[model samples]
Target: MLYSKQKVAKAVLVLIFFTVVLIGITLVSLNNGRNGTRSLRSFVSEDTSTSPESIDEALQYFIYGAKYLLAAVKSTVSDNSANITAVSHSITVVKDRMQMLLSEFEHHLHRTEILSFLSLPVINNHNFSYIYNREDICSKKAVKLVFVVPSAPGNVEKRQTVRKGSRGDYVRKNANNTILLFFLGKPSPGSNYLSLQTKIDEEVKEFGDIIQADFEDVYSNNRLKSVSMLRWISTYCSTAKFVIRADDDVNITTVEVVSALERAAETLSNFIIGHKLIADRPSRNVKNKYYLSKKEYPPPTFPPYLLGGLLVYPVSTAKLLYQAALRVKPIWLEDVYITGICATKVYIPILSDPGVVFQHRKS
Candidate 1:
């Protein structure tokens, strides 16, 4: 947040007002001592008639008042100097904070230009290959929409939950127009790898909806999973009018998504929509889970991005974004790298459809 100019001005004015009040009190006290009166009111009300002795006493009072006035002025000046020094320090702190905010704002405002100029990782078609693919799923069927979910090999229960929920029901009801498939990579090699792969093979045999690629399915390789999905869709499901990239944990209202797409059939190509995050600054704290080092992304703020939980875009846009990703370096954050950086490269706008996507919470 920017430091408020009005607040600073008001504070300075208040300090000055208090300084003047202190000076007035000092002068009043000096006057009361000179007249030997309890208060200024009593001194003013005393008799003015004077003899020669009284005149001499009045002259003495003037000399004392002058001396006391000078002393009081000096003390007030000293106090005010200290106050001015404190105010200067405060202003310096506020200035530094404001500069940081402005610097971040500048990065956000011009992110597209910066992303375009930065060097990115380049790759060829062989960067990823499919270990298990079902090209026949889209080749034989006239698919209007496809839902590609990136799943970890160990998340067998989550996959089953999706198959049992509305997503499964929607595909079952409209198999001709819709296709739902889970995208996965090899699980981390461990003692349980064989057991997990065996179960995955069984699920593939039973469901015929899982697509496995030749990459390690670790947290850092999430971007690889998404890029693989894009390449698969563009290669096999190009006829699909719309594609929804969803996380395994999200609960999608497939009915609403279909209805919305049907209503916008005339303008469904080369566009994307989902939950959008705008002008989000990259986390710099090393302890943060989403931290981005300056060496990785020098910019203070990331480009506008859609959340990875749910995203809806035309297959045409997905193809363009995939092409863009081939040249752009992948970031640690998959959502920011794919939807934010790659989408920006291709000039696709990331919008919001709150009613269509919801984060699923176990009740």
Candidate 2:
């Protein structure tokens, strides 16, 4: 077969064009491959129960991996100035996209993780903290404000002394100074609460300038119980910078709580009083928890609600958190519901300060 030089040249050009096209497609495929692997690792790593703290840790890991991967791509493009520089540059572009996607995922994981830990811990009968070290992290700093969560026991047999004060209100701590709130909930019979309510009434009368509310029947669902309480608190602290939210039954010396709250003024509000909650195997069906119901919440796990009784949230943070809590469906996990579902949404940091112990086990 005899072919002209021109014809041979034309055939060669066509062949070269097809070859380049094939190479381009292959490189694109390789870039997509890198992205797929990174995406899988970034979003779907493993199946395990994630606590808020663990979620934060995972975000850190994702961030670190992303940065490392990007650096590797950059180095490949910069250092390898060889025949494959074009391919390397393409690879780097793909790598950057993967990192960006992963970072977004990291943020999402953090949000969910925080909510996972928010179900309010039931600290009614048993104690979560033993002999607590009172002033560990929150020693005397400046003593900004001491906030109290007013707990009303249904039967107030033992609450005679607390009830006999000037105002006969739920917030009978010290009205003359500092801040106070009537965190209304189901009252218990053991604390002589009827009389205590009387005392609280008097206390309110004396220093009525205190911060307080009476949500005695707000929490029929645990999902919004802590949130309801927090909203109750935030309404009072409109001007105050810092706040301390604590339980009535739990033993916390006013002087001590106030001192600690001052130190934490600079730290994040929307903080929960933390103790190692003795987590028994909760009912496999999230609905098994009394606070949880399938109608409002169909999910199997509770939102990260802190124990409803005690916590400290800054006024501004509390407002944002309460709004977020309203947005989420009720999950019946009281504490986690507030911290993870509500507070976590704003990217507000939730912290546990020393001296502000939880589960102190006392009546």
Predictions in order: lDDT: 0.69, 0.46
Model 1 C-alpha lDDT versus the unseen true structure: 0.69
lDDT of 1 by residue, 1-363 (tens): 111335323533443344334434444544445533455455334565652253234334433443454454544344444443444443333333323222323333334564564346565343677778998888896898898888999889999998888878877876548888999999788999999999999999999999999999998888888888998998998888888777888887877876655543332234567788899999999999888898999999999998888887778778877887788776879899988998877656565554557677473
Give the winner by TM-score: 1
The RMSD of every model to the true structure, in order and in angstroms, is 21.9, 19.8
**RMSD (Cα, Å) of model 1:** 21.9
- Cα-based TM-score, every candidate: 0.65, 0.45
**Which 10-residue span in candidate 1 carries the lowest summed lDDT?**
98-107
Candidate 2 C-alpha lDDT tens digits along 1-363: 112335434533443344334433534344556543444233334455753354345446545655675665565556544434657666654554444344334434455554554444423211112111122212323333545454443323223322333223323444423434334443334456576556555644664422223333334533333554455444434555555665545544445545565544432233444432323223446555354455655555544445555566556666666656655554555666566555556555444445665444334
- Candidate 2: stretches off by over 4 Å: 1-143, 153-177, 185-229, 253-264, 267-273, 276-291, 294-296, 303-305, 359-363
